[model samples]
Target: MQIPIINRSRHPLPAYQTEHAAGLDVHANLAEPVTLKPLQRALIPTGLFMAIPVGYEMQVRPRSGLAYKHGISIVNSPGTIDADYRGELKVLLVNLSETDFVVQDGERIAQLVVARHETIAWEPAEELSETARGAGGYGSTGMQ
Candidate 1:
């Protein structure tokens, strides 16, 4: 399915995907650097904004290269962008490694994947059917 994206600027920046199966890469281009110290968190902004279509949302995920190479990743991995939101896309990055990280302009900080979500109506139930491992919590099954 084709997703319509509305660029808000006359000379709007382009969003790119390296490959057909790849997620759309978002960039942040500011005059000053966006640094994250050890265990520090900050919101890095992309110079551009987008208008995502209804019935769809954008999932912001970490770039494998950045996470593995620099220990930098999105604090809220797969951050959700609701359809109703109309603002600049910002990525909340955290530095888990013991060093300062610099986010440069036009850097592919995060990947955006379009996803479809469903809203379900809840119905109250007095009792639920029992299963073989009813009420099992974490590690209920043996770990080999």
Candidate 2:
């Protein structure tokens, strides 16, 4: 399936992949030096917009490199992008580490994954079936 992408700027950006069942990487370009103090939140622009198909959603996830190296991560990791939303894609980043994080323009900040979901009808049930580890919560799986 072909996905429409809008490049408002004069410069042409790399093509957005719609065939592959993978996430699209978003970049943040920091022309000047700026710091994101610990626990500080900021809106990072990706300079891109997309036309996503209906019945599908895009999940915004953080890049491992950015999280591990700079302690910068998506405030709402795996943020959902509804298909009907026709607006500029923005990244909300938060600095977790106790240091100022420098973000450069064109830096890969996060990834957008298109996913499919199923809506099910709910029918009230009297009870659920019993299991070997019934009602076991959290560490019920046992520590590795």
Model 1, span 1-144: residue lDDT tens: 665555443333545555565577777656678888999988987755666678778899998888999998999998998878878778998898999998876677888888878877998999999997778889987644
Q: 40-86 in candidate 2: lDDT tens per residue? A: 98988766788778878778988777899889889888898888888
Every model's TM-score: 0.84, 0.80
What Cα-based lDDT does every candidate model obtain? 0.78, 0.77
Model 1 CA lDDT for position 25: 70
Q: Model 1 TM-score?
A: 0.84
Cα error of candidate 2 at position 34, Å: 4.6
User: Candidate 2 — which residues are off by over 4 angstroms?
Assistant: 9-21, 29-34
